[model samples]
Target chain A: MPRSVRVRLFATARLAVGRAVLPWPVPEHGLRARELVAALEQAYPRLAPTLRGSRFLRNDRYLRDLDETLRPGDEFAVHPPYGGG
Target chain B: MAVRLTRRPLTLAEAERRLRARPGGAVVVFAGRVRRDRRRGSSVVALEYEVDRVPALARLRALERAARRRFGASELVLWHRLGRVRVGEVAVVVGATCPHRVEAFDAARYLIDELKTTVPIWKEERGRPVRRPPRRRARPGVRSAGSGRAP
Candidate 1:
């Protein structure tokens, strides 16, 4: 059986924290970071507006698209524009 | 006091004190301040700074580590102040302690230069561009991501 992937969010992404862990179902071979975001938005309609305006990161680096396949133990995040001081 | 970010006021003396060590031979300090330009009045208005802390800290730690490895410096300090700062107030301060003048000076300059292009901090011009679409402010130690450097 394929192991379930763990996703972590920070800053703006943490808004979907109604539950500590969401049982994210992944594709048989796993999905990319962007696809995970799409699935997350579908599951949590309340976060739709924020989902449109956010950028996603797999690990600490920014991901260019949603189709990048997720690897086991890969961490994901959604970030909002933070003003730089 | 040292190697930290603060939302309150920045004190130069405190920064120097933090960087100065008993056995270190030299201490270097660099303070970035607000200056009046033609766009503003004779007196400068307040300067506001915003930062994305997560990425900012990541880059800061990277830069500091690089400096330490390349220079073999004894110690280093970084302080950044946010919110309404008046003219001549310190925005960012960097201090390095080393055994000689050359390493201290070189590391300090490198840190400041990298900061301007990389650290993900933005500035507001205050008077102009207020009504325009919210633009991303320029940050130290950062480039547009295709420059091929670590910004």
Candidate 2:
């Protein structure tokens, strides 16, 4: 079976993609976070601008490095600048 | 219990009560309310707040620990309201209790600032559409220049 990752979008990212969640395909060995983001940008060109300003999360944890590998069935989230108080 | 992301209303009284649980010489509480701001000729009626629950809670907990370690906070309250919050409603309540007034104030400030910049929460304003003035109709027998009526 083909490996996949769950791409979660929040706030502006969700608005740009018009959905809260997306299933993104990946290789069995998974791909680097940078490559996954690039694939997402290619798939949703409108989301490129939002992606540039967003922070990434891997399975509910903030990712400080984009080089981190994302394995199959992992949940990756795109969070725009926070506006909470 | 100190860190919360609720969907219900947040009250200053509740936050104060929570902070009072710990005996401290100084307790500071800050409440953030949704304002009816004007935007593009429209008025903001409410703010819709959304969050990625698991991560938001995790970050809040981390912030709580940091506040305690850095500010010597004996007690802390970092409650934030989710969903649609109307104008003038309390959107968030942050409080800190410390042995001294300075630490309490600083801790409270830090809590709110960090929450805004670090938490995984977002708010979108919902505004009322701008109302335009009704156009005046040319009265009968009133000769308007643009109506092609000779003056």
TM-score (all chains, Cα) for each model? 0.58, 0.90
Candidate 2 residue-wise lDDT, B1-151, digit = tens: 8999998898888888889999899999999999988768888999999999999998999999999999999999999999999999999999999999999999999999999999999999999888989878888989656767557
**B84-130 per-residue lDDT for model 1 (tens digits):** 77777888888788888899999888888887776756665454432
Which predicted model would earn the best DockQ?
Answer: 2
How accurate locally, in lDDT, is each candidate? 0.69, 0.92
Give lDDT tens digits, candidate 1, residues A1-85. 4355666543344555554245466766777776777778887786667678776666666678777887766666555544333
Model 2 agreement with the true structure over A1-84: per-residue lDDT tens digits = 438889999999999999999988887677899998998899999999999999999998889899999988899999999999
**Candidate 1 residue-wise lDDT at B51:** 60
Evaluated on chain B only, what are the TM-scores of all the candidate structures, in order? 0.77, 0.87
Docking class of 2: high
- Model 2 interface root-mean-square deviation: 0.6
Q: What is the lDDT of residue A33 in candidate 2?
A: 98
